[model samples]
Target: MKDNRYSLTGYHKETNEELWLWDDLPELDMEIGYKVGALLHYEQSPFQEISMIETKAFGRMLVLDGTPQVTAKDGFIYNEMITHVAMATHPKPTKVAMIGGGDCGPAREALKYKDVQQIDVVEIDPRVIEVCRTWMTQETDYDRDGRIHTVIKDGYKWIQEQKNQYDVLLVDRSDPYGPAISLYKRPFYQYVYDSLTDDGIAVFQSGSPYYNSDILKKTIGSVKKLFPIVHTYLCSIPSFPGGIWSFTIASKKWDPLKADLNGLQWQEAKYITPEVFRASFILPGYIRSKLEEK
Candidate 1:
């Protein structure tokens, strides 16, 4: 392994347990460390380094390029919030397009809706899906459901080819870096705007409000220029850096705040309820002030 700060190294010496340390927010001089009970799998894929490790705290975790992507314990919070908010907001989301959710967490939640007929998952790296399927057995079995069509291609290019097709578009990508950098920019967002139906709604996982305010602002700002209705929401995920994560929902016709989520039913969803949906959009003063910045 490379001798970088992000590398998964040996024992911590103090506790004598293997440690997987990630310097995700190096600019802030903050790092998150996990006690690794076992290293399940580690390899270099065509796009990035992938690792599956069992941690004492978070159970099985999927790490990508040294950053923790998802953990078995609290991943439901993220998956449920990202999927259900937009799903319930739109009246009938029949066709869906998901970009960068190779772990199938968002896919799993989206599939729970009976109105959803098909989902096109465009993932840049095939290895991410392969590795997650092998180790993250708790995730959705994509093979069992014919509604999911997996396309191993760059999300930026794949989205450009689509137009007025999907009823809902889910951008479940990582932070703006590496292969995902383009996904956060304006050109890619324009493609996302174009790919949606007239009444379509799109949801993106904007990063932490406390740490990634600039990113959240930029993402919402860009999408606001394209869509008539844009609103930002919040969810708490224990695995994330700031504990509080933001998601932006942009719609062509419907207002998410006025969404009649009373009829929507998903027994499998753990974090999101109709009441939770209403409260998620109620952003704090600090976050409102950040978005208001010039």
Candidate 2:
């Protein structure tokens, strides 16, 4: 029953039609596969290997370093959860800075608020943006929106040069690996702290609690040391390893639980609603135990 035409990394060297792509999670000794209709694009950028594949289930998918980053169908779940939770929690977020959201999902969600004046998207790999623009136009075609300023630079380096600048800081980068490893450390969290306004808020995609508990623990633990208030929230993203994913929100003053949605204009959002936002922070008993673990 083994399929010789599909490799763990990519389509087999022998054939191209009806291929399978697997995201290998070595930590858990598991891998997830998608039935690909076609390998739309593939290339080795200066930073990493980027690919766009047409999947039978998810429509189109953006893969980085042989892992699926986002898909055309359920990508809104991650993007909306990450962006809206913090944006809604804050009183009035005008200036925002997003690190490593090259696919522009978080940026697109952030743009829905009329109060947001500017958004700076710092991505290390230009090809991520390029590939997303070309193949995933529905998600990445917001470049024409004047409020967004795409900065092709390293996020860790870029944030270090700023001070008291952004009202909201969104760390939407990849998992802790390669160039992004630094972004999940204490020093980078300090930089995030410094880059935010007095009452600013910051949020990070901390990965799945079931599989990536250490990452969630580290993100919450690290940010807790710096910010007066920190909370871990969960959302469901069908394309991710575990359908359930975690996000950490850190604040200088505002309480995310006390988010005011009466005046906010976000009717366009498909995933996040008032009830869902309130319920997202209500972690399960095991997750609470996971956060409490040493």
Candidate 3:
């Protein structure tokens, strides 16, 4: 294949190439990939293959199946953005629910807020949590946080039992494939709508628009039917395959782009400022045009 910007996979074996190429997926001919320094831990769980690696540039990384999920160097960008955007928009968010954030990045970030009292993180795989706790404990301290409640179960089934309970609901799923496929559909979003309070806010990681526009488009469309205000935001994480990744925010009452973002601060956040939050909603011409199309 032509090693273009959209090249899906790249890794060097124990040869002189000096790097290992990891694909976001092996089936997709044009999905993006990354180079890692060395594999730290690899295991085949009952759910999926879990791997941890010491990246050459992005620091330590947590991989699910064959794709990159979280990285130590810049994981703050994704986790911080996902939590703060919704947390700041709501006037007083006390209860939060997270689905598929097995790495605990979202839970740890959410606990940093003063108003947040309890955070319920529902992850399907116990292995992802165990591996991250063992290898990436410094980056995420979800287990020690008294405000977090970790539950291992199917996210789709878990949300159906909750109704109008959470002030903010975050879906930090891996990808729109496998078990996460249902999370991208409208019914699950309807459940998400019912799972949040009247003025609740929710955000989920839509895949990279540059490489996976279809998922982003589908997510926006599905979320629009349930929420009055829906906005898509972007962040650039070096560990992820595409240079740009996206998050779609669905608000029942407030507009995230217009949320009062004055004087908001995060303890260890590296990215995500009021200026960056505003700019993230302003999508590029090609991506915006594609999203606007019928």
Candidate 4:
């Protein structure tokens, strides 16, 4: 028989336990790892270091700047939550703008809605798209869609050029580290505010409150300054550092919590349901208290 036991090549393997340690939380001083099968693609993009690895458990995974951006097994949790909640709230979100979703996950998820007529994906690094297309084909395929437009440019600068344009803007940006740092700032949220229609809605993946509480608080504060309705919700994904992840919705008009889901049908969704959608907004007291602080 060919040696088909899960391969652990190129990963930091221990003598007794073979694992790939994701050392993202240094201050917390803990690491998470997955047994790996193969090293598919690794590259240094102008923006960040991109790597695609085939894991023993989570299927194909995309890691940017040493953080797991998406995995085949549970990507729908992140993408669907980010896209559907806001998309469902708006009565007619024809024009959608997705900033920094280079892997095509968010674009693919957003494309599922029949109401979304046009989707513009502004990805800063073309390398992330190329790698994802070549290696992570199973999770994403928005490049083939005629309605989707892929722009290789800085998302912050790109959003500034538009005014009252997009009905739904989904910021599927990387962690607030390198080129993505600007996307989490107050000015960018103002740009996002300007880029939306009067009834437009926006949602971005706020980092984990378990590990990145500061990010969640800062994001809520910045967005609250511009939008009358600013809400934060939680979604859990195993591949990310903390099992619990956060996304914030900012809207000029519609309140996502009271979204009328009278006719929305999410046929392809593995995670999000109408009931789950409403429950996601109901945060725990601790997290709510954090957001409530000045």
List the candidates' TM-scores in order: 0.93, 0.94, 0.89, 0.91
Best by lDDT: 2
- Cα deviation at 69, candidate 2, in Å, is 0.3
**lDDT of model 4 at residue 153?**
89
Q: What is the lDDT of residue 294 in candidate 1?
A: 96
Put down candidate 2 lDDT per residue, 178-204, tens digits, no spaces.
888999888999999999999999999
Model 2's lDDT to the true fold? 0.86
- TM-score, candidate 3, is 0.89
Q: In candidate 3, what are the lDDT values of residues 70-104, reduced to their tens digit?
A: 88888888888888888888878899999988878
The Cα RMSD in angstroms, rounded to one decimal, for candidate 3 relative to the true structure is: 3.9
Measured with C-alpha atoms, the lDDT of residue 183 in candidate 1 is 89
Clashes of each: 0, 0, 7, 0
- Residue range 49-148, candidate 1, lDDT tens digits: 8888898778899988778899889988988888888888888889998998898888888888888899998898899888989988454456789999
* Candidate 4 local lDDT, 199-273, one digit each (tens): 999998888887878898988888989999998999889877768989999999998877888645577788888
RMSD of 4: 4.5
Candidate 2 to truth, TM:
0.94
Stretches of candidate 4 off by over 4 Å are 1-21, 138-141
